[model samples]
Target chain A: MSKGKIYLIPTTLGDSPINDVLPPKTIDILSQLQHFAVENIRTTRRYIKKVIPEKDINQITFHLLNKHTSISEIRHILQSVEQGIDLGIISEAGNPCIADPGSLLTREAHRNNLQIIPLTGPSSILLALISSGMNGQNFAFNGYLPISPQERIKKLRQLEKKSQSEQQPQIFMETPYRNKQMIESIIKTCHPETLLCIATNLTLSNEFIKTAPISYWKKHIPEIHKQPCIFIIGA
Target chain B: MSKGKIYLIPTTLGDSPINDVLPPKTIDILSQLQHFAVENIRTTRRYIKKVIPEKDINQITFHLLNKHTSISEIRHILQSVEQGIDLGIISEAGNPCIADPGSLLTREAHRNNLQIIPLTGPSSILLALISSGMNGQNFAFNGYLPISPQERIKKLRQLEKKSQSEQQPQIFMETPYRNKQMIESIIKTCHPETLLCIATNLTLSNEFIKTAPISYWKKHIPEIHKQPCIFIIGA
Candidate 1:
């Protein structure tokens, strides 16, 4: 049997309609796939149902992968693909492998020489980036900061210095609930003249993207507690 | 009059069908816009025609923005938006403000406090990253390399060191025509153990993506001459 290809599918950022962020081809491909490796089975099922409602959800098989997933299990998941069963890796939010655990499976796919196809969709990182009006020509996405206050602040200083020397925007994110604390750290640790961009609730109705210096952000910080946000530190 | 939004629209990476990469909202927004800021007028006009065949192309007003465009010109283009005229920034290929000159307009819009809504679409950089099976959690896109071979090799060394130090992938690209030169430089300079990913003709019918060590690549280098490509150096 011919080896099945692995489709790297993307899910919506939030409650926004799928049509607003995804192409028609994504749904067309999802309808034919019966095996999937997903970050969250429930969310992936819901996303698939939103576009391909006719499918019998019970007929499909799901493999759950997270930070706890092991390499042996990842290889086990690909056994189906080895036998000509196609698999799709769907993330809870955004593109698989981007700020998510999808890359683990993708890496294994490369090892096995399986065809991996990545579909285009709503990526908060890319969306926040294009809207920030920062330096998009050259930028980096440093997924998340350290949880420790001191370590996080030190990392911020390092990113800020790199952004200045390279004249590039340094992009990063934080856990939703800790948005305020992240804001405070940036405001306090970075230079006053350093430009910062805070992009929150992207693709949703209440989307907000603003770029300003640390001094301006000190007095007008928004209520982004528990909101998904992307932060960029640049010139 | 209420202010109009600056729609950061995206074009296809190559000749892939519009519906294959862009969402329905993109064509909807493009149909209604009478003003556009584009990298190249001819390509943008052709793109609009492909999606909105019935619309008369002549009625739309386009402001060309490129490497040579001045900040004053970008501000002048926004005069209509200030008067509630919706404007879309279209690039020759892929998303605007990403490895394109569209950010000048986006930056000016931010300066004026205009609403900048970035629509989702194909981004070669993001697509390549997700497909690479590399560390997408932490990565950087250094848009291009120095034309001079020596400087280009030096920059490659810097990126490779940074990649090894951070355990992050350093993504970069080169002008299509000089792709072979780039591949040669990587084979000759980068460490044998270093991993490299070369994604070519992304989103097109003939897409190619592969990640392997420099030693493995030395024995088998694919023909990527004069083809749009993205390269990544990682651990």
Candidate 2:
């Protein structure tokens, strides 16, 4: 029997409309699958219901695969795929296996020689980069910076230097609650003339994306408290 | 008057169904726009027609923004947006302003203080990484590799070393016709234990994606001549 495929499904970024970010084909696949390995079972259930209202939330099987999931447990999750049962992996938001715990399952799926398919969907990082007007041809996504204030400042300086010398934009994000502090740290650490782009609430009706010099942002800082944002710095 | 927004549109990867990669909202936005700055006028027109067949193609205005477009011409393209006319930027395939010529227009739009909006759509690089089972939290997209054989080999070795030391995957692509040669160079240059993932014809029915060590690839090489492929090297 052919091994079942592992599909990397993408969810909406925030409160964006379901049809705005996901294609009909993705929804079709979600409706057909009965098994899912997700970062958060609650959010996965809510998202599935949003996309497929007819789907029985109670009938679907959900396996936890967050940061707390053990490596051994990931192997057990792939057992279903090996047994000819197709499985889907969904993150809390955005595309799975990207800045999310879904990669653990996909990594294990490869070790088991299972076919992996990634369905099309929204990705905040790509949306931020393409709209930043910075160097998209060459860029590094460092995920998140050091949480400590002092260490974060040091890292910010390093990123600025790298961006100027390499002519490559540096992309990173911070926890939503710390979004304002992250922006403040960027303003306080980088040179006044450096270009910084902040994209918040992407794909939503209240989406805001702008890129300007640090000096310009210092005079008119936007409120991004407790909101998801992707920051990019370049010369 | 409020400045017109610049929408960074996404085109299909290949000959995939229109509804498979793009959302209905994107099509709605595409149908409403009358002007577009595109990498290739022919492909952009074909894509627009596929998505919005009822629209009159002759009524739309297409401005070429490929490698040959000059800085002065880009400034002229933004003039329409400044006049309160929204414009869309489309690449030959995939998302605009990403390893494509659309960035020039976006950068200029930012300099003019225009609102830049990136609609949700398919991105091949992100799809490849998400499916590669590689590091997605911290990764770098190096776009295309050097063309010279010696330079390409040196770059491949550098990428392999970076992947091992940084624990970050390095992604790069090659021209479709040079797909096989690129794979040969990678296998010949990287260490046997280094993991390499090759994803080709992504989002299409005949799509093929695989991840394995360099040694495994050397023994069972796949034919991918004249195919769009993304390669990732990781430990």
Candidate 3:
């Protein structure tokens, strides 16, 4: 049999179905596929449940395809594709491949000359930038801040300077646990009047978008620590 | 009356609804607003008609708010918001405020402490970037290249050097008519080995994504200039 196509599906980050609007039809398309390679089987099961609330989870076959999975598993996924088995790849949130492990699969697929179809969906980074009134004409998305506090601050400083020089915006994010420290670093290191945007709980009821100079944030010291957030510093 | 919220709704670039996937709920929200500010009132009205097929065009007001519009008009838009009248703003296509006239209004809203809600929807830049299989981690979407051919080539050269030195992707596009010329310049100026991605008709049926070194584009000159495209140069 001839090889089948690859579909990169987008998943929601948290409770907001607002971003998952296309998942129902997406799942319908995946149902006809031969394999559904998901970031996490259990998580994908939960998402599939939420997307098609009336369906039974027991009917779906989800294969785990995250970082922990070995190389052999990936080869098996490729082999399935080679056998004309349609494959559906999904992330835990947003579109797959960007700052996600699924990129490796996408790269491999391209190398093998497989047909890859990317479905349209919500992206937290773009949503944050579009909503935050920053230099949208030119902006950079640096997936996540460095883990080390010192390195992260250095990166933020670089981001701020780049934005200023190019009159472009720099975008980055931090894990929930490290968000507060990231904010503190921005407050201490960035210039007083430097523009900064913090987008949190995007697409959810608790969503908040704060855009102001670094000085403004210093005054309030927002409680940003345990939230999934995106940071943008403008030049 | 309490001041109403201002929303930056994203529409598509052309006359078709295929590129537009904004939910019906967003259209309903847009229809109820007293002031609807758009990049081109005529074009926006045509797109809005596609989304809300049954709405009476006479019932809704569309304010032309392109760069040519005066500050008084913008002030009036703000005044409407201040007076508790909700307003809707849209660009010709994709999300407003990003490389669109809505940015100025958004900045003004930020300064005035008015609520600005960004609904999740189509984004031409992100759609193009993600589909290109280019470096999405570190990317800069420079709005448009210089109109003059000499300046455009110079800017491309500068962006090429910056992209190489900094290990970041640089994205820029030309107006529809000049796309062919830009492609020719990119082929001539950029090194043969440098990767170039042309994402055209994004999110539509005839959508095309071509990622190749300048060498490959030089070979396929005929097909490259066929559509409205976004040119991405990846390091």
Candidate 4:
């Protein structure tokens, strides 16, 4: 029997309408799948219900695959797929296997030689970069910066230097609750003339995406506490 | 009057059905817009018609914004938007302002303080990375490699080293026509153990996305001449 395919599904960025981010076909596919490896089972169940309310939640099986999931357990999750049972990988939000632990299962799928399909949807990282008015051709997504004050400052300086020298924008994210601290560091560590873009609550009703010189941002920092955000710095 | 918003529109990767990649709301927005800043007028026109066939081709105004477009001309394209006329930016394929010259106008939009909205859609780069089973948390998209053979080889070596040392996947593309040459260089230059993923014809009927070590790829190289492809390297 042919190995089952793995679909890399994308969820809405926040509470945005599913119609605004996901295609109808993606929904159709979601309705058909009976198994999933999700970052958070509760959130995934809620998201699936939001998209396809008619979906029988109890009919579906969820395999946990978050940061805490062990490597050995990941291999076991693919056993169903190896036996010709198609599976879907869903993240807590946005696309799976991206800055999320879904990669662990996806990597295992490859080892088992299962085909992988990625559906179209909103990607906050790409959305932020395109709207930042900065270099998009060449950019680096550093995921999250170091937590320590000194290391974060050093990393920020290094990113600023690379942005200026290579004409490449440096993109990164911070823990939502630490958004304020991240902005504080960005303003204090980077050159005044550097351009910084703060994209918060993307694709949501209260979305705020803007770019300005660091000096200007220092004078007008927006409150982004407990809000998902993506930052980009460029010269 | 409030400045008009700039919508970053996404086009199909190939001749795939629009319903497969773009949301219905995106189509509704496309149907309502009368102005667009596009990479290729002909292809953009074709895409618009495919999405909303009821749209009157003669009623819409198209502003060219490809590599050949002068910097000064990009500013002129946003004049209508500045006057409160909503505008959409479309690329030949995939998302605009990303590895595309649409950024020139997007930058101008920010300078003019126009709201920029990026609709959700397929991004081959992001799609390839998510499906590659490689490191997705931290990755760099180096748009294209150097054309010169020596420089190309050197860049490949650098990318491989980065992939192994940092576990950060390196993604880059090649001119469709030069796809074969790019693969030849990858097989001939990088270490036999280095993993390389070549994702081609994404979101299309005949899409092929796979990852394997350089040694395995050397023994079985797929024909990708004149095909749009994204290549990723990781440990």
Error of 1 at A175 (Å): 1.0
In model 3, which runs have C-alpha deviations exceeding 4 angstroms?
A1-3, A18-34, A54-63, A67-76, B13-20, B222-226
When candidate 4 is compared with the true two-chain complex, its DockQ is: 0.83
Clashing pairs in 4: none
* Reference-based lDDT, each prediction: 0.90, 0.91, 0.75, 0.90
Q: Given candidate 2, what's the lDDT at residue A82?
A: 91
DockQ in order: 0.82, 0.85, 0.46, 0.83
Please write out the lDDT profile of model 4 over residues A19-137, one tens digit for every residue.
Answer: 99999889889999999999899999999999999989999999988899998888888888888889999997799988899888888777777899999999999999989988778
lDDT of 3 by residue, A37-107 (tens): 88878788787677667776676657787778776777778887888888888887877767667756765
- The worst-scoring run of ten residues by lDDT in candidate 3 chain B lies at B16-25
Interface RMSD of 4: 0.9
DockQ of 2: 0.85
List chain A TM-scores, every candidate, in order: 0.97, 0.98, 0.91, 0.97
Fnat of each prediction? 0.74, 0.81, 0.34, 0.77
Whose lDDT is greatest here?
A: 2
Residue-pair clash count for candidate 3: 7
lDDT at position B73, candidate 4: 88
Clashes of each: 0, 0, 7, 0
Candidate 2 lDDT by residue in tens digits, A50-111: 88999888888899989999998899988888988899999977999888888888887887
